[model samples]
Target: MTKSQIGLRERKKAATREALSWAALRLAVERGLENVRVEDIAAAAGVSPRTYNNYFSSKAEAIVSRHCDRIRLVGEALRERPPAEPLWEALTRATLAPFDGAAEQPDPRWTAAVRLLLREPALQAELARAGADAEAGLAAAVAARTGADPGGLHPRLVAAGVLAALRAASDVWLRADPPVPLQPLLAEALRQLAAGLPEPSSS
Candidate 1:
């Protein structure tokens, strides 16, 4: 009933959500998506199947929730960047923060699993919805920092474009024949956007 109690309750809910999501992703990676079920995920997370259903409708949603949480956190990070920092610079740093330490090339098995997950229709839908939510959150942060209207074209367009660049960069990284450090690829993606996406010259 008190403020501290309310905060603690919300924190507990968030922790439970994260645990279920983490379990789903781990199961998918270890046993493949088709082999995993909501029951399996709930057991892994030490929650009942009914509790899992309260948080996520399907296995795909549970798996994608972890990535979406990171996306949502990027918006929070952007809001905390120095107010005087250039918009693109702050945006780039916030976006890359979640992925910075994961610079090592991915294992081929993980890449294969990710590729499979990306191709799933349920996950694709979840990802699309997550992108929209992330764009809205980032646009609000941009509006606050730059004194622009969150619903206006400038904030909306910038947020949408930034997320698009993120998706493109992720796609490129997944398809890289010899896997490369994702942070550099993601940085290059944002850098290209900050530069107005200049065309490359032929060698």
Candidate 2:
């Protein structure tokens, strides 16, 4: 196949994967995870059950993949950033790129739905498993940008640090007594990380 054909094929596959992931999350939210089957998710995505099987082994995996898709997109975004941009700046933009046009404040109903879905034990397990893969994807992107070895410590640390900020930001967002905009929290988290996480002076 020509290079353009190959690119088109990959884009189609990505769209399908995203469709399945989003469908799984929506169904799991609308109906509890236990009530939603693989067939249901596939149907929601307009794909066959067998096609869903090609992308995800379980409903939990399909749901978790929605987040993974964002992480993977961040990697792609980083690659496209201008070479002169500082690493942390590029990373911040890359991370937030997937969220552009997102409401500064997240909708409470959507947050509630996500919280309910995340409480599932099976989904928790899937998140734990997926975290490593997410980190590796980011690490590879960092390596590619800096010409570091893909397996080296620097890229690995940078990836781990970014993920840590994301998780911290997420936890704070979810647990905030008075709801706050996630974008600011996310930006702050990355800024702190890039600044070496300085100690706060006591009042």
In terms of lDDT, the best-performing candidate is 1
Model 1, 1-203: lDDT tens digits are 99999999999999999899989988888887899988999999999999999998888888889778878888999998998899999999999997765647888777777887778788899999999999999999989999988789999988988888888888888878798878888899899988999999788
Q: How many Å off is the CA of 140 in candidate 1?
A: 1.8
Every candidate's CA RMSD: 2.2, 2.5
Which stretches of candidate 2 lie above 4 Å from their native place?
Answer: 1-6, 101-103, 147-150, 201-203
TM for every model, in the order presented, reads 0.88, 0.84
For candidate 2, write residues 1-203 as lDDT tens digits: 99999999999999999899989888888888999998898899999999999989888889988776676677788889999999999999999777665456666787788887899999999887778887888899999999999999999999999888888888787766567877788899999999999987698
C-alpha lDDT values of all predictions:
0.88, 0.87
Candidate 1 segments whose C-alpha is farther than 4 A from its true place: 1-12, 101-103
Which pairs of residues have clashing backbones in candidate 2? none
* Clash pairs (backbone) in predicted model 1: none
